[model samples]
Target: MPWWVEYGRSFFPVILAVFLLRSFLVEPFRIPSGSMIPTLHVGDFILVNKFTYGIRLPVIDKKVIDIGVPQRGDVVVFRYPPEPSTDYIKRVVGVPGDRIGYYDRVLYVNGEPVTERVKAQALREDGQEVLRVPEQLGEHRYQVQWVPQRSSRQGEVVVPPGTYFVLGDNRDNSKDSRYWGFVPDENLVGKAFFIWMSWDSQRFAVDWRRIGSAIP
Candidate 1:
């Protein structure tokens, strides 16, 4: 045994154990965009349940254990397809073999329009062009925003097996499958279920209302 290895033998297991714990358990992430707005806000600290999907070797992203699959309405954090180092948050809109379409700001799943009843739209004076769209997705209800007259990314996509389609609640602002492509099942990190805190220098204050809120 190398001197360094023997010197830390007593603590080697402890160090490796911590690595295994974080690799297969919960991981922390900070929200950097409004893509998941209302559900998760900028600066909000979040915890992702890694084992909910399956167990994958860290860094390599190869699943070694088959635990289960992602369910509809689950908010997830994943690596951006174009940039793996960067992480993104979005709601699972279409699962494997599901047909997903978007037109006129409405979502259609499997050839049927997923119902969304608009509640209200807010025009913020911050010049960011944000309009909130609150709707009930089956039993799960949440608010998303549609930027006025900014509907640019529009199209239809059929999710393929071993891949999932994701969309941001800030539909008009999010760069998701609509722009890039489907997220490989292996790329999924975990489900995001809470908003621990939020802050934006542009907003200039901590959003107390969002604290401790359960992500819908």
Candidate 2:
């Protein structure tokens, strides 16, 4: 009956709808670094499907519904283990109970190499030349890049249950699972599936070609 109650009645529904959609449906994220360079570029505005894995409540990140789990080769966004406040995006290389190895610029799972082609060079957003490879991980096919002459991490680790090993598309330049550790199931934010907009900060230009492109 009061003025404040009337104002709340008009706006409460709209605010609640937005909150529910962002928390349970899809969320937007911006690429701030070149970690996933070839697949995702810096300044790219992307969308993450929150319900791809499962329905987790917002803030505390507790899953109340069973839907799905992360799969190999899927590009996912998760909270950084070292700092849960930070969200990181990477490709899932090793799922639960999988053995992973990286040597000679090749990735191996369960002692078998994941198929990839010869390195093809590409220009980075910063104008540096980096080597790229067309690799297939499960059903997802994508390209990964690395700086020539830079040393990358190489080691073998068994992915623990309820955790996954992830790596950036920019191999040598990225400090990912190779540097820290695996991503826990609960830390996952969502699956990155689309790029709605792209802004190349270096050239100060909008990449119209990348706009509306689906992220593979």
Candidate 3:
């Protein structure tokens, strides 16, 4: 065999294996915005379990296997409904057939207010006061930031089948489903489960504390 042919044969299988594993198993993604701040930070490298919600063909994102659906409070990454080429991450707030509402920064599902309590007070980018609170959804609990002085998008709607309602943990700073609309089931990429690495580009260093941290 020619030298070039031999080299290609040796490396092709390894490359194909990696591609299949990443496409069907777990994939790595980097956080690029503070929409999920406090839960996921900019520059945090996260691992997403692709098979958790079932296997889908890469690029096309068409599911071919039966698996579980996203649960409330699960951090998820999905293709932007308006711009399919772009990916966005947020916490699932409502699954199919659920009535979801957000008014004055408080969430109401099925006419019941989600349980939350003040955790602390902090300042926003515009020097406005914001409250940090822990909100419980299903069996998961996480912190959310709310700016009381700023008006929040408010309304209630029934989540349609094959779609989901999502919101960012940083309620005041995020532009999420409240703005663009529900995420289609087919747009789902995976469930974010952990932060494998973190980098602070502004400081030009690695954030050792965030390394290997589990996603809440």
Candidate 4:
């Protein structure tokens, strides 16, 4: 065999193995927006556990096998459906087969309102009043904000099987499932659980307090 051919055969499999391991084991992500603010701030560097949803192929995003399904309240990173190369991070509000609804800023799942209570009302950096919902989803309780008078993207969506609906904690500013559509199981990249670092260009400094914070 030609020396070049012999080298190619040996090198290809080694390259494939490394790519698969990085894609399925852990992937690095950078937060580009304030959609998940408070939980994940803009400029935060995060690591996503890719195999948590399932073992998906890199680049193509095909699920050849299944590991498990997403549970409600899990923070996830995935490809934006309209633009696959763009990535997004949000909380899983509805899983496959869930009946999700948002009416007048209240969230309802399976016809039962996901109970919420007021935590605090505050003004955002943009001078908008935000109503914070400190609600329990399963065993997890996290804060989500709603801005009164701001047009809310409201709708009732029956999540199809092998898909999930997600939203951001900064609800009003987020372009989430409410805007685009459900995230396919295959599109899932992984669960984002921690922030290793954060920096805000506007502030011109590192957000030292956000470093090492867990993504709720």
| Model number with the top TM-score | 2
Model 4 Cα lDDT, one tens digit per residue, 62-117: 88778877788899988888998888889999998899998877789999877474
Error of 2 at 184 (Å): 0.8
TM-score of model 2 vs. true structure? 0.93
lDDT of 3 by residue, 1-216 (tens): 899999999999999998998999988999999888778889999999999999998777678997999999899999899998898999999999999988767788888878465455566654667777788898888888877777778899999999999999989889998999999998998999999999998789999999988988
Question: Which of candidates 1 and 4 reaches a greater TM-score?
Answer: 4
| Pairs of residues clashing in candidate 2 | none
Superposed Cα deviation of residue 3, candidate 2 (Å):
5.7
1-216: candidate 1 lDDT, tens digit per residue: 898888799898998988887799978788877777667767888778899999998777789999988877788988888888888889998899888888888788888766464655667734676666665555577777777767557678889999999888878778888888999987788988777777766779888877887778
Q: List the candidate 1 regions with Cα displacement exceeding 4 Å.
A: 1-18, 115-118, 200-206
lDDT of 4 at 12: 100
TM-score for each candidate, following the candidate numbering: 0.84, 0.93, 0.92, 0.84
Shift of residue 44 alpha carbon in model 3, Å: 0.6
Q: What is the per-residue lDDT of model 2 for residues 134-177, given as tens digits with 9 covering 90 to 100?
A: 78888898888867777767889999999999999988878899
Better of 1 and 2 by TM-score: 2
Off by over 4 Å in 4: 1-21
lDDT for 175 (candidate 3): 91
User: How well does candidate 3 score on lDDT at residue 34?
Assistant: 88
